[model samples]
Target: MKREIENKSKKKVIIKRQDECLRPSIPQFSVFEIIRATNGKLIAGSDDLSVSGVSTDTRTLSRGNLFIAIRGKNFDGHNFINQAIVKGAQAIIVESDFRFDASQGASRINKDNLSLKDCASVSFIRTDDAIGALCNLAAFHRRRFKIPVVGITGSCGKTTTKEMVADVLSAKFNVLKNKGTFNNSIGVSHTLLGLNKEVDIALVEMGTSNFGEIKRLAEIVAPSIGIITNVGYSHLEFFKTIDSICNEKYDLVKNLKHPFIAILNGDDMRLRKKAKTSKDLNLFTFGLKKTCDFTATNIECARGVLEFSLNKKHRFKINVLGRQNAYNVLAAISCGVIFGLNYKDIKNKLSAFIMPSTRISLKKIRGYHVIDDTYNSNPLSLEYAIQTLSEFDTKGKKVFVMGDMLELGKRSVMLHREIAKKIIKSGIDTLITVGPLSHHAADAIKTKKRSNLKVYSCGCTLEARGILLNLLRDDDLVLVKGSRGMRMEEIIEDL
Candidate 1:
């Protein structure tokens, strides 16, 4: 079943892959158990009522479900209490500060007044913070299961590495993973809550834009294993420096259990330095470097697929695009080794790794080979995408449609111009910019006055859409990418 949980930031997390997570065969949770898990108080109903699943949004609540009333910047779940009750929510977890507002559909309950039974014996519980309670209950639920939970965080390839690790683990285990970019506090909680009797292990991707978020997610997940893909220029608006980003990412390793097993990119100098000084974590290094614990050599990308040899003996061929993904693959291979899976099993499962199309995917769209990396963008990811596009053996011209990269704070323009320098050195023939910041890249390119490179600077995607429809030719290789807020995917849709 599809579920959407709106966190405090108003991010609507829509679960796409039902089979991968949120299994129907879940362990049962009673009202009393939730109270213990969340440190919540039973306000008006008996503590004996039980539920098999929990939901934050009333729109996705099912019969016999326990709905947690969440408050967000744009919406509040307490206002939808009547809808959840009418839809057969067995219990409700509301904030302790909530008061009865029948006009707004708020549920009224008190210690002496247990008669508000709009539904059959509905239970009501109160907590200081519903979101914290949700995370706390998820943490409590995670401890009940005895399985290796791998928590991954990095500026790039968090989702890709999560998928690759899940694919490898699935060879010998019933692996569980989050759907889409559900890597924030609420997303990780929902993913942990998806644990059931059937789940052999869980892979939780931790994503953050601010400090302390990764630490909070790590506490909620309590993973046995951890991975940091790499540290780079990502979300600099909240974290103004690379050192701060490194410190934030190290939170995953720091919050992992004592004597933790952390798989990290040895090529990232910060991570390697941290690994050298780590006292609690048993670090495993994976990269193309020969000094790494798990090294990948002989890397190649052909027909938009990555092929590499692990430790120069075991080979891996995956469908994920870009040569940079060899690092992502090596991270998963390290985790597979940690799982005690044989080299042959890891090899057999490597082929099953499918690149999420919304990420760095190469596709034949409208008669052209299109690389739709429109899911999100940062300086590091965008630079690699440009390299992947420029190196691609296409029969026609190479075009890059870049949108504004968000959250860079003061360095947005400088980073954009920096991408322009990279593009100028590459084989790209045409550059089309979608938003204001990327226009800086286009302007930087125009100053060179090179006849071989053509530039189109637009104020928005609507302007770029019309130009691309007429400019694109058959057998062309096009790269469309931008930050999530810019909605760069609209250009590909028009194409």
Candidate 2:
């Protein structure tokens, strides 16, 4: 009788498995949740629906993902909606009044004899604006998690500082950080949507070229901790002035509610002033100065490593080749301190932290020392790079290869001339420049009539590369830097 009962139980379990195989798994975000988050109108599909993920690009859209069609200056996402659906997109969020042409058959979509039921099977939600709706949805998704989100913004070192902060936090938490330069509205939204129960923290790096950009991003992220690396003369074409840049960058900290900490660069005069006057902010400061809450002293740079003492006691070393990184390290240390991390653990983590590529990356090429700072450039960053090159001990000539710093607007000439003065004063042996604005720097050097200085202004990267190849000597220390548009890294490749 017992053996008969066991056989009956096994049969019942097998029948339940067969029934489960007949049904499919549901997606993560229900159709109602999408409508609520984006305030979108459901054009088709059942109300009880869900998606496995959210995607902006049809090329990478996975099966059961919600495709958001975002329109940009050069490309329209509306044109790719059909393609997204064909690629197994579970649903699509688009602008209102978007027309669906069944004639254009997508990969999985059957064009001929398609009906409302076919459209309903692949859900469609329409909003007033697709990008705005994406931001709304990301904001809603972010609220689902209560983990700490750290937002970093500045004219320079935002990316590096973001990476450092994430590395420090990863010592105790599973960290999710903005990849590459994904700090804009669309990028931040995608990053926020990636947050799940597994992630312990999110380090978001925000970048902007115009006013009110940071404010919009801040509203979406609502960071628990805000960090401003430093306010510098970057994107002056839109910001117009350093004070304007400061106001724009400060929006991140300004948007945070009470019970949040503002990590500020105490070395920056504007931020220092703001820290002094800003009321009701839980502020923590970091810099090389003694006044900062987290300070670094006894700094040393040798063979592409930066060693410094934190708070005049704890010693730390980072394997990056820039003295300006000291400020970035100090900022990260402030964060670790705020989070109750011990000094020893913070030092251990920082020691293993490596800098992102193309930002002051030191390399050796064919018996020449190359400092590739070609990722991006601004007045402040250019000055720092120039100083770093000057400080390096070199056997052969010290060469400075530069390109124009774009988006400076009316200040382009003045800023380049200012950089020219620094180059001349730095005692660099050779200065090779490219681009039209960089001519201002070469001209500034020519006006000085320094017989010891060799200045060459090339019209393009090819010409610059030829000049560098002919001039480079064994053991020469060369620093290549420029704006992203200039593609300064190509010069290094050519050499």
Error of 2 at 198 (Å): 1.0
TM-score of each: 0.91, 0.91
| Tens-digit per-residue lDDT, 1-495, candidate 1 | 333433212433332222443535765698999999999998766888898788999888898888999999999998887777777888899998886344333334332233355544778889999999999999988877766678999999999999889989899788989998898888888988888878877899999999899999988888878899999999999999999999999998888874377889988989888777778566778887887888878888886778888777777888878888988988888787667677789888888777887797887886888889999999999988998987788888999999999999999999999898899999799999988899999999999888799999999899998888888899998899999999998888877
The C-alpha local distance difference test score for the whole of candidate 2 amounts to: 0.84
Candidate 1 deviant stretches above 4 angstroms: 1-24, 101-116
**Residue-level lDDT for 97 in candidate 2:** 74
Error of 2 at 268 (Å): 1.8
* Residue runs of model 2 more than 4 Å from their true location after superposition: 1-27, 101-118
- Pairs clashing within candidate 1: none
Tens-digit lDDT track for model 2 on 95-192? 98786554433322555344445555788889999999989988988877666788999999999999898889788777888889888999999888
For model 1, the local distance difference test gives: 0.84
Question: What is the Å distance of residue 492 in model 2 from its true position?
Answer: 2.1
lDDT of each: 0.84, 0.84
